[model samples]
Target: MFINNTWYVAAWDREVGADGLFSRTIIGVPVLMYRDSEGRLVALEDRCCHRGAPLSVGRREGDCVRCMYHGLKFDPSGACVEAPAQGRIPPQARVRTFPVMERHRWIWIWMGDPERADPGLIPDTQWLDHPDWRSQDGYIHYDVNYLLIADNLLDFSHLPFVHPSTLGGSEDYASISPKVDRLPDGVRITRWTLNTEAPAFAKKVREWAGPVDRWNIYNFTLPGILLMDSGMAPAGAGAQDGKRDGAIEFRGCQALTPETATSTHYFFAHPHNFSIDQPEVTASIHQSVVAAFDEDRDIITAQQRSLSLAPDFKMVPLSIDAALSQFRWVVARRVEQEQQQAAASATGARPAQTAA
Candidate 1:
């Protein structure tokens, strides 16, 4: 149910280079990624065209890669430039190349329609590039459908239950309904818990005394990238009015990269405006986030197992599903558009562009 013709984070900036080949599956496509001689990132199909050997096992020669099994060398354009015993290269001796882009210390790859790969389509995440913030990041591999993991994020009501000790405890936090903004390509969900005690993790850097007004805003771009804006200030302060001075604020990002129909890669980074000079602040945020997200992984895995065993079973939505329901609708519409375009192309029906 993954959508093609879009960009997905293939790996973190640190995950792809300064070493041998990086092999991973994105949307069921096995890709071989590495840095070239000029320090450019290149992604090609991992399978060799001839003997079907994994190209990742081969070594790099200048800007191209030489297959270790046979002496076939492929340039960055995916064209086979050299052959061992054969003097002339076969016209079919080429691998598929995926469009790759690096932004915000992450590597993004387009899985389909190389001509339509747009860098502007990549989500806006300027906070990661901001100089005033410090961050900590981590990765997790989940054995579950990517959409299920997205569902958990769109519906934040689980925070109080799943992360009681870390992010939630008050009944009011989970009971608040989110204000949803239906965008052409994504969804924006904002929630406010006024004059409430800050969660355990937030309490570590709370600026004022007593209860503070807390706000959470989530901007989810299509496919699986999220920018979360969260902050807390004095009860009477204008936190919602954008008067964030002397308040505790943090920006968090979460990206889900589908490896297969039933597996995904979770990448996240948390950057905060407060406590920028304290090393311990970053450590605290990272530890609590990891602990909470690990709980998220455990729960999602269990749900995936249950659904796998009972493929026919359907779970009904609850009252708190307003935002998640919208999220599902947006994703479903995009997936349907992709399917229709693919089908039309196969039958030469002149595919129609979907209206946003």
Candidate 2:
């Protein structure tokens, strides 16, 4: 049920270090990642080709991994270099390697054909690495499917009831209307509230004392990435007119990676342009976001449990679900394309792309 022929966030750059090997399951594949002797990262199938052993349990020798169950050794290229007690290595003694790239402080991996993996397809998250911006990175594991969280990001109408204390105000929960657009690759949702009261979290982060103009610009990119640019400015400030000189802007980079059919790994980074040098402000923002996501985790898990018991239950569409429906359509189309390509490849045939 996972999309293979696409790039997905494998891990945050700070997560896998040079000292130890990191093991993760992606799209039902057990993968191992680690830094070689040169401090560069490598991704490969975690299973040993010979004994079905997990290479992650082995020792790291230079840039190669030695299987602990047996004495099989695999190089960074996934080639079996040494096999103890065997005089010669078989031709099939190798593990599969994945195309990996480290950009914007995130390790991205391609689970399909390496030739089709385009680095340009990865969304631009350069702000998280800018010198003048302050960023906080956090992670959460969800028991629900990643699509469920994607639906959550596309629908803000639930904020009033779900995040009443943080992001949702009395009127913003279900009243604020969003303008939705289908991007070439994903969906975009934009909503601007003029001269409105800021919520508790927004007030704490932006230090807005009274009413202010706020904007929520959320872009859901391909596979599963949501880059949200939101902020608040003084009341009567022409924020809609591009006048944000005194405004506090916060950009959040959220990447969702599926661990299994029913589990997901959420990596989120909150970057603010206002507090470039304040450690306390960064810490506060991080805590607030973690709390907010924790709130989401509770609700998503409960929904997942209920859905598991009732798989055929359909979500009744509503006015507020317009954007979410479009988001789901976009994702389903991409997944279908990938599945078709895989089937074609299995039959030794080439698949043609449809014109937009």
Candidate 3:
């Protein structure tokens, strides 16, 4: 399981309304999120202390969340500010509040110890600031473990068989070799080439002119975020050189937060450079990609069910799975390191021995 100690994309900042409540599950934990009257975002454990009802089901009252069950009000800090029934605050009455921040139009939540929540820990995205890139937001729910989806994203080999209609045409099932590189600050980059004719989507872009060569950069930051650079260059040009020409590039970032062991909340943003600044052109590109993603949703969800039923099932992987293996190992190592740090903290908190 992915550790809860890392940062996960919660929601788009614009999606959270000042007077509305939103409920979402992150890493299998139900959480209630909202913005205060000042437009500051806040997150708290969803359960109401009064009767265990979800706080999100309640209404907002003067910057506090008022429970519908008994009119109990909780402040942004999770304090029971008003309990009409009791008329006084109980010593033990409080909901767990989490650290949240808004960045690049997205709301991010820190699920681990609040003391360790550092906004700087979130991966830096300088490219988004570039004037040339145009950004689009998308969301989807997947009935599968977040890991399965992560693995799928890291492996391009499945494109031919699983996503032939969408982004799979370049998949040459026979000769795919993936390479992985570890970078500083818990960053990993996976690279691979899919050798096949361009898919319909790529062909559409090709109609503008030039042959097609696809080069992919699969970047995995700590926790559950994935940044993908899917670029198509003129055919016959080397992979590196293809990027220099007027190629159609799709840069997508995905945040997969586990709703349960078998369900996940998938949030994605695609910011591109080609014809994206224009609303009409951007809408056309967004629609095309969304159609492809809908196709993948069916394939990934079924794959998850199949894997769950047969725990021992293992298939021979092609060379393309090398990067995936690297990714899995990196995640495992990070989780292990976090566990060790937590254990060490616990040991240091023990009471000291009295003088003998």
Tens-digit lDDT string for candidate 2 (28-74): 79999999888888998999998798988998898999999989999
- Model 2 lDDT, residue 166, Cα: 72
User: What TM-score would every model get versus the actual structure?
Assistant: 0.95, 0.96, 0.88
Q: Give the candidate number with the greatest lDDT.
A: 1
Lowest lDDT block of 10, candidate 2? 166-175
Tens digit per residue, CA lDDT, model 1, 1-356: 88888889998888887657889999998999998876789999998888989898898888888899987999988999998999788899999999999998878999989999999998876676678988876899999999899999888889988998887747789888889898876789999988888788887655447788888898987788889998788777888888877678888888999999999999898888877889899889888888899999999999999999998997898878777778788888888888998899899897777666
**Deviating ranges (above 4 Å) for candidate 1:** 206-208, 352-356
Write the number of the candidate with greater lDDT, choosing between 1 and 2. Answer: 1
Report how far residue 115 has shifted in candidate 1, in Å. 0.7
Cα error, residue 317 of model 2, in Å, equals 0.7
Q: How close is candidate 3 to the true structure, as a TM-score?
A: 0.88
Ranking by TM-score: 2, 1, 3
Taking the tens digit of each residue's C-alpha lDDT, what string does model 3 give over 1-356? Answer: 66777788888776788768999888877899887777888899999987898988898887888889888888888999888857678967889989998777668899888988988888655444457887667888888888778877776667777667766674463255656766532345544453347666666544635445667776776676777787766666566654446667777777778788888888876777877546766666666667777777888888887888999998777665666666666777767767776776788753433221
Report the Cα lDDT for residue 40, model 3: 84
- Deviation from native of the Cα of residue 307 in model 1, angstroms: 1.1
2 versus 3: better TM-score goes to = 2
